[model samples]
Target chain A: METFILIGITGIGLGALYFLIASGLSLIYGLMGVLNFAHGSFLTVGAFVGFWVASKMGFETSMPEFILAMLVGGLAAGLFALLIEQLLITRLYDRHIDQALVTVGVSLVVGAVLGGWFGNDLRMFPAPLWFLSAIDIGGAKIPADRVVYIATAVLLLVGNWALLKFTRIGLIIRAGVENRNMVNALGINVRRAFSTVFFLGGFAAGVGGVLVSVYSNGVSPLIAATYLIYGFIVVVIGGMGSVPGSFLAAMMIGVIRQFANYYATGLGDFVVVILLAVVLLIRPQGLLGKVRS
Target chain B: MLRWKYSRPLLGLLIALLALAPILGANPLSRPGLQQTMAVAFIWGGLALTYDLLFGFTGLLSFGHALYFATGVYVSCILINHEVVVWWLAALISIAVSALLALLVGAASLRTTGITFAMVTLAFGEAGHVIIQRNFFNLTGGENGIALNADRIPSLFISVANTKFIYWAALAALIFTYAVIWWVTESSAGRVFAALRDNELRVQVLGLNTQRYKLLAFVISAALAALLGAVMLIAAGSAAPRFADAGVTISLLLMVVLGGAVTRWGAVIGGIFYSIATTRMQDLTQQESFKTIPKWIGGPIAEPALVLGLLFIFVVMFAPGGLSGAYYRLRLRAITKKSQ
Candidate 1:
């Protein structure tokens, strides 16, 4: 029972990380109709930049320097996404295939540049000392880091909801997701929404970068690349562009994977893939996605 | 239509010269490294052509085509290397299994359209790679990759001295691939494929099941990729995990796009160009003169991904038609001007 409890909690922690990545992917795909291959690079940029900031700022346990690092990382990633949107994505306009291909190119270039500019080795990312401790829950000892992950995800989720419901940009975004052509006909600047979506998506992915780095032993150039596959799966399963759906799917997949991994080592990934195929077979449009055509 | 009579003889002659290039160009290609590079290029050209059948002709953008190619290698290598079966039987079985895999995976992936299809195929391919790298069932040798067992390999296709035969085999395979693709593309089904790419709604209005035609293209393309993959194993004498990597699929995409998607010649040329660039560019960077270049320039130059990716972007942006498109564009203009 204790083991099960611990494993289940760890699964949620994993899901929390997956949701952070998937939410960005889901929102971006929903609005722009782009399968942004470079989304992973945003996460990587955030992680590397965040680490650099931490190193320079000097880690102080009492001062909460990691939070600042995470914020700065997300902001940097957001700006980078904006640049890509303006320079590459906007030029392609409504050419969805071209946009997707351009993202693939961007992803390759960014990954290569990061690898070439700053070696491909995995390096340590220093976390707050408080994150090193554990808390007991239901006789199962849970890592303190899991709590932070869940909190951050929930906070972001509510924040995303509030932004969408309460703000003018959010209202335009909501309308654009339903029918961008119609929204454009309504004289709203749907293009600005594209940039906003990219920025926001990149921000979430950037945060995911820091969270994922903290979850593991360290960060490597391929860190987000490894996670990007799962993010895609999550986005597809959750119904592309549905935040609430993503949260549910991420948690379900996470728990299922944890249980599967417990039964047999490394079986979870295979099981998850099968699950995706099965989902695709049954629900081609995804769990919450509207029929595109 | 006007010069179809002249084009056939010219094309046949080009192929004949290609098959006999190893002997005719013996001076330069005799270098084992050059021969091996050319052999890989031929296989890539074949793979890219098949990929074009799906992506360009059928309008399916698959990022997971490497799965079928990897299936051919792993199945054959595992059987041969582990002495599970004779080489010929293993090779036949590998090809068969790859077709079956394409059917199953294609059926599942074809359920989704556009971006979803691309992602689903990618996931399935990534899963295959992971299974191989993880050494599932303790058969794949994990990260070490599987080499063709020396004892089981045929006498005609083993050792550095036999690089010539391997080179010829790869050429034969490429020619066979080209012929099959050409024949299929000329058939009625090929017309349907073109229709499906241009407008599925119109095809659906004609009461045709677009999915069935798409599946046919997927299976045929995958089968062709598998055959070339077996040839690839023979050429390289091993199956590395990277054969199944997502990077390989991306490279195939690069080949098709660079050569021009709809044009068969573009696929082959793009494959050959990409292969030569990949192998030779790294070597080019390794040269003494290149070593003295500034770090800023040298670093990006050394990374093939950046260069190839930039080139792909350039093609997509400026030359949407690729090399064949550019050629056709110029030729069409000249004809128009002359007629006027």
Candidate 2:
């Protein structure tokens, strides 16, 4: 029971990380009808910056200060996302494929530059000491950091939900996702929603990057890409543009991968990929996605 | 002067030169090293042309082409080393398997279009990459990669000194690929592919099943791409995980775009040019002249991806038509000038 509890909670933690990346992908694809290929770059930037800030500012011991670094990292990524949106993506207008291509170019440039500057080895990310400690729950010593993951995901979900429910920007975004043509017909500047969604996605990517670095205990140029694939899987399985669906899919994938890996050693990834194929074959629109006409 | 009437003779002359390249001249062109490079370029030329059949001629923009290419390489390698199959039989089987896979993956992936199509293909390719790395049954050799069995390899290609034969083989593959593509592009089915690219809905409105046409293009291109892999496996004498990386597919995309999409010969040019330029760029970084340049400016330039990536962005942004596009534009201006 204790082992199951430990695996379950950690699985949820992994799912939380995936959600952080998937939510942004879902929202952007949902509203803008654009698939941001450079989305993983956003996370990479945030993680490196967050690590730099925490180390330089000597915040390794303080929980609040480290959290501050994570936010700063997210802010940097958000700003970068805005720049990409305005500079490259918006210029292409409605050429969706071209826009995606530009993001690929940007990702390549960024990836190479980072590799040139920092080299391609893993670097340890400093986390608060308490993060590594475990708390006894149901006779299982679960790592305390997982609680933070679940909490952050829940908080972001609720916060995003409230924003979509209450705010005018969120209203436009929600409307845009449902029917862009309808929103445009109603004289809504649906374009504004694209920017908001990119920024939100960027910020969330940053936070996830920092948090995942802590989870893995290291940061590398290649780190986000592996997770990004899983994020893409989560989005596809969850259905593009559906936040709640992403959360459910992420948790399911995370938990399944945990137990599968435990049982078969190196079989987790392959199983997940098989699952993705099955889902794609059976439910092309994803678990909660609307039938796109 | 630039008439299409002279194209056939010009192509014949070009083929003759390529065939005689290893021995025709002593001006640093016939060296074994240079021949090896040219051989690889020819294979890439063939590979890129096949990719064009799918992305350029047809409307599908698949990002997982590396899966087919890698499938050709690893399957052949494993069959010979592990299953003890003959090299010729292994090559044929790899081609067959790749085509069959293209059928299945295309059947599923074709359900989506545009962005979703790209993502679905990418997911499938990534799955292949991971599976190769997993080294199931010790056949794939895992991350360390697998070597071609020496005794199983054909006697003609056994010695490293026989690189010239490999060069001829690669050139033959490229010519064969080009001929097939040209024939297909001029066929009635090829006409449907152009229509599909321009407007799929319109094709559907014409009462044609566009999905079937797309699958046809996909399978043909995949089989041809596998041929390139077979040639490459013989050229390199081994199979590595690098062949399956997403980067390889992106490189194919770069080739097609740089050479000019939809144009019959553009992909060939793009592939050869990209392969040669990439190898040259890495060499440039090691030159003494590079040391004279400032470290800051030269540092990023040394990373070929940074330079090539920026170039790709420029091409996508400013030169939507690529090299062939540029040639056509110039020819258009010249014709107007002559008339005036």
Positional deviation of A80 in candidate 1, in angstroms? Answer: 0.5
lDDT of 2 by residue, A1-293 (tens): 99999888888989999999999999998888787878989999999999888888654648887888899989999889999999888888888777777788888888888887777788888788888899998999989899888888888788888988899999999888999999999988877888889999999999998998888787777788877888888988999999988999999899888988888877888888788888888998999988887
Give the C-alpha miss distance for residue B193 in model 2, angstroms: 2.0
Cα lDDT of model 2 by residue, B12-41, tens digit: 998998898777867565787887899999
- TM-score on alpha carbons, each prediction: 0.97, 0.96
lDDT of each: 0.87, 0.87
List of chain A TM-scores, every candidate: 0.96, 0.97
Q: What are the candidates' individual DockQ scores? A: 0.69, 0.64
| Deviating ranges (above 4 Å) for candidate 2 | B1-4, B292-296
- Model 1 lDDT, residue B92, Cα: 82
Q: Which ten residues in a row have the lowest lDDT in candidate 1 chain A?
A: A55-64
> Which residue pairs collide, candidate 2?
none
